[model samples]
Target: MPPIAILVALADPTRCRLIELLQGGPQPVHVLAAAFRISRPAISRHLRVLKQSGLISEKKFGRENRYALHPGKLAPVQRWLAGLLPAARITEAPAVVIPAVEQPLPKARRIPKPAATPVILVPALAAEAAAPAPAKPAVSQMGFDF
Candidate 1:
């Protein structure tokens, strides 16, 4: 899977929260949503994105779906990060930082700040003013709201 897709899925705060919950252990959709501040459907949408990204896997038990981390897909990401860090001490003796004359010190990588990105803020009253009256979905559904 493309890294961008995984990044996009987690770009949403709700999806990030859902992933955080699953990090502890597998959880039912209702249980996951309880930790979120959004509506049930909104959480469902976040879960959908997560499922598509291969970050999470869902198992159906009767009417409910239980989601868990997909470690197989996650291992590569972890390995990639581990590759960036300094290697472990070669011997039991206290490790010495012997600078190689051939290779200069590795430059620190600069990470962009998340806060530098633009954010869209919606005030309660302004949001309410922009809200459209409820339009029922075309199909009836039974789902849990935690």
Candidate 2:
């Protein structure tokens, strides 16, 4: 199966761009950050995600960390995509037919539904329902009540 981590890592636009940048050659975090409008920390986070997915490798050169692309990590993804192509599909073998014995299904027991009971309102509630609602105060065009 193709590494799902690679797909997850590539899902982000920042990470995708980071991969593209690394393709040319290994670059330090500050050099990669210079290419983007986002903060250096944000670029570092994207690089971290790519590293976790095994799509890129980090090498320390003195004080600076350079990230390089590992193209072989994408082989599984390529193979998985190749399988989806029309030409990659193999023809299926002929299926053998075997007659199955049929058995009658048992009848399901039916339960009678209960009739709904009528709702009875109390005298106090009925009186309240009969009373007219209070009229709302009239408001001017400015929305202020007199």
Angstrom error of the Cα, residue 114, model 1: value is 38
Per-residue alpha-carbon lDDT of model 1 for 1-146, expressed as tens digits? Answer: 33566767767776766776776678898988776556889888888888998999899989999999764565544555556554742223332323222445578999876666665666867787678989987664443233
Question: For model 2, what is the error of residue 136's alpha carbon versus the real structure, in angstroms, after optimal superposition?
Answer: 38
Query: What local lDDT does model 2 show for residue 10?
Result: 93
Candidate 2 worst ten-residue window by lDDT: 92-101
CA lDDT of 24 in candidate 2? 75
lDDT of 2 by residue, 1-146 (tens): 66688998998887887887777789999988887777998998889989999999999999999999997798777777777785775443333323233466678999999999998889889988889999999656663234
Cα RMSDs, all models: 18.4, 24.7
The candidate that achieves the highest TM-score relative to the unseen native structure: 2
- Itemize residue pairs with steric clashes in candidate 2: none
Off by over 4 Å in 2: 86-146
Candidate lDDT scores, in order, read 0.70, 0.81
The segments of candidate 1 whose C-alpha lies over 4 angstroms from its true place after superposition are 79-146
* TM-score on alpha carbons, each prediction: 0.50, 0.58
